[model samples]
Target: MPIRQLPDTLINQIAAGEVVERPASVVKELVENALDAGATRVDIDLEEGGARLIRIRDDGAGIAAEELPLAVSRHATSKIASLDDLEGVATLGFRGEALPSIASVSRFALISRRNGAEHGAALEIDGGRLGEVAPKPHPQGTTVEVRDLFFNVPARRKFLKAERTELSHIEEWLRQLALARPDVELRVSHNGKASRRWKGEGDLLSDVRINETLGEEFARNALRVDHSGAGLRLHGWIAQPAYNRASADQQYLYVNGRAVRDRSIAHAVKQAYADVLFHGRQPAYVLFLELDPRRVDVNVHPAKHEVRFRDSRLIHDFVYRTLHDALAETRAGSAVGVADAQPAYDPAQAARPDYNWRVPTRPLGLQVEETRAGYAALYGAPRAELAYGAPAPAGEAYAPPAGLDGPAPHPALPHSDDASLPPLGYAIAQLHGIYVLAETADGLIVIDMHAAHERIGYEKLKHAHDGEGLRTQPLLVPAALAVSEREADVAEREAPTLAALGFDVTRSGPQSLTLRSVPALLAHGDVEALLRDVLADLREHGESRRVAAARDELLATMACHGAVRANRRLTLPEMNALLREMEATERSGQCNHGRPTWARFSLSEIDRWFLRGR
Candidate 1:
C-alpha cells in the first residue's frame, strides 16, 4: 500500500484487466496487430470458444530473431517512436500493452521468420514467465499460439460466458472487422472445423461482401451514398426507410478506418431520418467518415471505440445534410419511381439481350397544368371540396358520395407519349374509403388517401413557411423566466440565432431573461418550456432547433386535420389531383407520422399471385 514498485508480472496482470477481458478481446488485439503488420490473409484456429487454445497465423512482415523478446516486453512496440507518432497514429494497434498483458494471463508462444531468413525463431511465455528465444522452423510470416487463456487469473476466467456465447462474440467482432477491411482475407475455424471465410478483393468493400456480412435484404434495399466537402468525405450504403430495424445492431460507423461510437454522429443520423422513419424504429447503415487523421483524437479510449473530433458541430451538420438530401429523393411522384427504384429480377429475361435494368424515366412535358385545371373546374376551390363531398364546418362530417363513383365521369387525361403516364398513374377506384387503387404502365398502385394528402399538405406548408420566413408577433407584456447562469450565457451568446428563429430574448437579471416576441406559428406553445429545451439542446449539441421544430409540429397538426378523413370517397379527378400534388411534393412517400403513403405491386407480381405465366 506504500509507495513501492510492483513486480513486472504483477504490472502486466493489472494491464490484462483492461486489455484482455475475454477470448474475443484477445482475438481483437491479435487481429489488429496482424492488420498493422500489413497482413493480407489471417487464419484463426480456436478450440473451446478460444478458452483452451487460440492459434493465429498471418502472412505479414514477421519479427527478427533478435527482437523476439522485446516483442512481448511491456511498453515496447515498433509502431511509434516519438510523441508526434502517438498524436496521429495510423496503425490499428499501437498501445504496446496487448501482447505482454495477454501473455501474463495465458500460455503464449510467438514464432516468426522474416522474409529471406534462412531460419526462424520462437519464444514462449507461461503466465508472465519469459523463456529464452530458440530456433524453430517457420514460414515467412508470424504465428501466435495462446493456450489456457486466463489460466493465471482465475477471477477473469470465471467471468467468461459459455463456449457458444463466447464464440458468438468473437464472430460478431470479426464481422465488424471484415466490414472495415474488405481488402484482407479472414478465415476462422472452431474445434478444427472452418466456420467463416471472407475473401479479399478490391480497394473498397464490394457488394458481395456487404451482402454476405449484412444480408441480401440489406444489400437489396441499400442506397449508395458518396459525399465529400469541407475537408471531409463520407461514403457507404444506407438502407431505405422501408428497411428499418428494431434496434441499432446493424448501425456500423467508422471514423478513418477505425470503428467508433460517437454520440454526435449517432444523433446526426437519427435527425436525418427523423422525418421519414416511424417512432421507435432504428435505421440500418454502414457509413464511413474520412477526414484528416490529425483532426480526430483516437486516444480517447483504450479499445479505440470512441473518438473526439476537433469540430464536432461541423461533422454533425455534414452527416445530417448528406443523408437528408439522399432520402428526400424518395418522395412520391419524384424522379425515382417506387416501382423502378425497387428493382425486380427475372430469371427468364436474363437471356434477353435488350432487357433494360435501368430505371425508367417519364417525359418532362406531360401537360400537368392541364390536369390541374380540369380538376379545379370540377372540384371548385381546393380547400372547399373534400374527397367525399363539399367540406362541412369544423366537427361536422361531409355527406358521403351518392355512389362509390362520382356523378359526372370524365375521360382519361391526354398524354404526350405512352411513357408519359405519371409515376402514381391514374386512379381507378376507391377501396374501403381509405386506399386509392390506380393503374400504372407496369403495375398497380394502392395509396392511403389520408396519408398521401397529409404528406402533400405538410410539404406545401413547409415550403410556404420557408419562403415567407418566420412571422414574429410582439407580446403585449414581455414574458420573464429565471434560468441557470449557464443558460443565461447561452441566451446572450446566441441572440442572433434566437432572432432568426423569431424569438427576441434579452437578459434581465443575473440568471433571468425576458422574451419580447415569439414566432406566430408557435404563439400558443409553452414558451418557458420551449426556451428551456432550446437552451438544453444548444448546451449539448452546439445547435438548437426547438423553435423550428415547434413550428413544424404545429404545421404537421394542421395538415393532419386538413387531410381527407377515413370513410371519405374520392372521385377520379379528385384522386388524380391529389396524386399530381403528391408527385410534385417532397417526402410524399411517407406521411407526417412516417407511415408509408403508397405502395406498388408489379404486373409480374400480380401474375405470380394467379400463376398466369406458369
Candidate 2:
C-alpha cells in the first residue's frame, strides 16, 4: 500500500465512526446544535427508535439560503473562525463534523427560514451525495430530517440495539439535556404517539422540575446549593444522606450548560459526602459548574463528553469545600424539607414522660464525666474543667443539679417560645431504653439516644484534635520505604501538603522515601498503609484526606466506647441537656457510622396514621 489521499465520502464515513455511535449519538449532536442556535423550544419525532426517521424542529435562528451547502460540508462551520474562537468556544457544536458525518451515513435534509426571511430553503444529501439547494415552504426556524440512519453502512446498522433499547438511549440523552436547560421546552413523539414533554421552566433549575425529572422523592429530599467563587459558579441540588441511592445513575454534571462527565469533580463530590453517606451507597445530585470558557478545554473528547480543566486542583478544592460546608449545615434542627410551625404547648405531656421501656439491655457503663467533658463546649467551659464534675446520686429519678438542666420554664410566654429553646424542641420522655421522644412545635420526634450522643462526642473530639494541629510523633530511627518513581515525585512535590498533614518525608532515592515523623494521632496505626494511601491520593487528586480520615477513625472509636449506653435512666433535665447539645452539633443527624440519629414524625402524618384525617 502506498500513501494516498482519501476520498471525501470515505473521510466523512470515518468521521461518522467517531461522532455517530448510535441513534443516541445522533440525537445528542442535533439537539445540541438546536440548543446552540438559541432555541427556546424543540420538538422531536422518532420512528423505529430513530432508525427509520428522526425529524427535529426548533424555534431558533436558522441557516441562510447561501450557507445551506456549507452547513453539510466537512470541516466548515459557523461556530468558530479562528484559533482564538476555538480556544474559547462557548457553543455546543464547534467541531462542524456532526452534520457532514451524519449526512454521509443516512438520508438527510436541512431546511431553514433565517428567523425573518420571506421563504425557507432546503438542501439534501443522500449517502454523501449533495443535491442543489432550493426554496421550500417552512416556518421561521430550522428543521433537520434524517431517514434510514446508517442505511449506507449495513454493518453499523446491524450493531444498533432493539427499538425499545435505542429509544431509551435517546430518551436518556434528552433527559440530560432537559436537566441542563430547564428554560427550554422539549416534546418527544415516538411512532406517531406523544410519549413525554418537559415544559419550559424558570431559570437553570426548579424544585418542580427536579420532582418531575427525578421523582417526587428526590425533590422532597433535595438540598438547594448555589455558590460562587474564584470566577466559578456551581449551583444545583444534592440529595441528603437519608435519600442517597445505591447507584450513581441520578448524578448529573453540566459544564457551562453543556452536559459532560468529569471524574475529578465526581470524586470531589464523593469525598464531600464521605463523612455522612452510608457505606456502599452513592449520592444523587444535579450539579452545574460554570467557569470562564478560557479556563476549561472542551475539545479533549471526540464527542465532547469530557473536559480538561486548567486548574483541576483548584476546582476540586472549591467543590469539596463548598459541599463540605453545606453538609455541615445539615445539622439536626435544620431539616432540609420539613416545615416549621409554632410551638403547641401541652403541659400534661411535658410533665408525664412516655415510659415505653424495654427489657434489660447490655449497658455500656458510660460515665457522666466523659459525656460532660465531650459536650462541655456546647454549653460553656473546657473539657479539662468539665471532666472533674460529678453526677447526681444513683436511683434518683431524672433530677439533676442546676448546671445540668435546660432553659428555665417561662411563666408568661408559651413554654417552647423561650429564646433558649433549640430548634429540635424539648425532650419529653425516653422510649424503649434506646430512644429519646421529644415534643416539637408540630409533632413528636424519635431520637436514637446512643447514636445522637456518639455523634456529639465524635464531633467534639474531632474539633479538639484539629484545633491542636497535626501533632507529630518523631521516630527514634528513620525508616525508608520504597515506591514508584512517580510516588517519590509526588512526595517531593507535595511536601507542604504532606507536612500540613503531619508528615515529615524526604526523598531517599529516585524511587524511595524516608519517613522522619508521622501524625501523633495515628502513630500506633499502620504507618506504611497511611503513607501509601496519602501519596496515592495526592498523586491523583492533588489532595489527600487520609490523615484526617485516620485521625477521625480513632476519635470515632473513642467516642463510641465513651458514649452513653442503652437502658440508662435519665431525668427530663438530663435528656434536655443532650437535646441542646445535639441541636448545637454539626452533622448530628447521623452518627459517625453513617446511621441516622433522629427522625421527625410530622403532625399531619400522625393524623393520617390514626385515621383522624377522615
Candidate 3:
C-alpha cells in the first residue's frame, strides 16, 4: 500500500485519541476553553458521568455568530496566531484541536451569542459531519452540549470506566482547576442534581476554598508561602511535615496559571522536604509558580500536562531554597506560636455550602539569633551545658529549682507583653520517661524527649559540617568500575562537582572510571552503586545530590545515636534546659526521621476532652 494523506474525518478521529481519553478528558478540554474565553462563572451539567450528555454554559466573551463554523475546524484557534504569540501563549486552549477532535468522536453542538447581540447562532456536528449554522436562542454567553461521547468510536467508548469512576475522575480534575483559578465560579450537576459548587470571589484564594478543595486538615496544617525574586514568584500553601499523605495525590502544582507536571519542580519540592518528611510518605501541597510565560514551553506534550523550563537549574535551586528556608523556621520555637493557634477542627465550617472563610496570614520573620540569645539568658546556661544529662530515678517527681516557683524576671531577657510565656514555656513534669510535659500560656505541650534531642544534635552537626565542608578519605586501593560511554562522559564532565562532594573520580578508559576517594561520612556505603546512581541523576537532571544526601544520612545516624535515650531520667533543671534549647534550635519541630518532636493542645481542646465546654 502506498502512503496517502488521511481523510479530514479520520485525521480528527486520530487527534481525538490524544485529546479525548475519557469523559474526564472531554470535560478538561471544554472547561479549559471556557476559562480561556474569560469565563467568570461556568455551569457544567452532566448525565451518566458525562458519557450520555455534557452541557457546559459559561458567562464569557462568546464567539461571533459568523465564526461558529470555524470553531469546529482543525487548527483554527483564537488563542494564538503568529510565532511570537505561540512563544508566549498564556491561554489554556491554544492547540485549537479540541473542538474538532471532540466533535469527530461524539455528537457536539455549540451555541453562542456575543454580549449585546440581538440573536445567537448554533452549529451542529455529528461524528465529524458538520451541519450548517442556524439561529438559536441563547444567553449572552456560550453553551456547548455534547451527547454520546465517543459514540462513533466504539473502541474508545469501550475503554471508558464505569459511570461512577468516570464521574470521580471529572470531579478530581475540576478540583485541580478550581485551585488554579479561584476567581472563576464553577458549578457541576450530575443526573439533574447538583454535585459540586465553587463560588469564586476575592483577588486571592480564601482559606475556605482551600478547605473545600484540599480538605480542612490541609488548610489547618498548611504554611502560606510567598517568595518572589529572580524573575520567579512562588506563592501558595505547603503542608507541614506532620501533615503528609501516603500518596502524592494532593500535590497540585501550577505554572503561570496552567497546571503542569514538571520533574525538575517536583524534584525540588522533594528535596525541600527531604529533611522533614518520612522516607516513604509524600507531602500534600497546592503550589503555584509564576514566571515569564516565554521562559517555559507548554506545548511539549499533546495533553499539555508537562512543561519545559529554559533555566531548570535556577528554578530548581530557587524552589529548593525557598521551601528549605520556610521549613527551617518551623524548627525551634519560631513556628510554635503560630502552630498553637492554628484553626481548630470544625466539621461544620468545612461542610458549609458558602465558602467565605478569611484568608490565613503568615507570620513575620523573627530574628533567630536574637531569639536564641533571649532564650539563653532566660535559661542561664549555654547550649552545651543543657545537652548533657544527669541520671535520676525513673518516675521520680520533679521539684522546681530554688527561687523559681513563680515567674522570675531576668534583666538580660527581653521584656514584652508575653515575656512570662516562653515559646515552649517551662517544663512541669516528665511522662513515661519519654515525653516532657510542660505548661504554656495557651495550653499543654508534650514533647518527645528523644526526638527533640535528636533534632537539636542533627542541626548542630549540620552546622559544623557546613563550616568545615565534607572531609574526603583516600582509598588505599582505588575502586574501578565499568560504565557506559554516557556515564563516563558524565563522570568526566561532573568531576568538579564530585570533588566538591568529597569524591575524586578519573576516567581510566573509554568506558571505565576509577573512584580514588569518598566522603568520610559515606565511606561505608556501596561506592559503586552510589556512583552509578549519581551519574544517572546528573545525566537526567543536570544536578545530583546523592553524595550530599548520603553524607547527611550518616550525620543523621550519628545524631540519633548521640541523642538522649528514652527512659533516661532528668531533673527539673535538665528538663527545663532541654526545653529552652529546643526553643532556640532550628528545625526542632521534627526529628531526623521526620517524626514531630512536639505537639500542643490548646486550652479549648483540653476543655472539650472533659466536656467542660458543654
**lDDT per model, in order?**
0.81, 0.82, 0.81
Q: Cα RMSD (Å) per model?
A: 7.8, 7.1, 8.7
- Candidate 1 lDDT over residue span 1-614, tens digit each: 67999999999999999888899989999999889988999999999999999999999999999998999999899999988888888888888999999999999999999999998999999999999999999988899999999998888899989999999999988998888899999999999999999998844546767876898778766777889999999988887786789999899998988888999989889988888888899999999999988888888887777989999989998998999888876666433322234332221221111112222232211223324443574335663233223333576533434553433332343332233346777778899998998876677789998998898778778888999987999999999889999999999988888888788999998899999998887788788798888888777777766787778788899999988899987667578777766665667888888888998887889999999968
Off by over 4 Å in 2: 338-421
Query: After superposing candidate 3, which stretches have Cα over 4 Å from the reference?
Result: 332-420
Question: Worst 10-residue stretch by lDDT in candidate 2?
Answer: 355-364
lDDT of 2 by residue, 1-614 (tens): 99999999999999999999998899889988998999999999999999999999999999999999989998888889999999999999899999999999999999998977999999999999999999999998899999999999999999999999999999989989888887999999999999999999666756656766888788767778899999999999888887888898899999998889998899899989988888999999999999999999999999999999999999999999988887876677655641222342222222222222212231112323333443453344453244334444697424434474443331221233443344566667788889988876567788898998899889989899878877999988898999999999999999998989888999999999999999998898999889999999998888788888888888999999988899997665567667666766778888888889989887778999989958
Please report, as a residue range, the 10-residue window in candidate 1 with the lowest summed lDDT: 346-355
- lDDT (Cα, tens digit) per residue for candidate 3, span 258-325: 88898888998998999999879999888899999899999998989999999997898888889988
Q: What is the lDDT of candidate 1?
A: 0.81
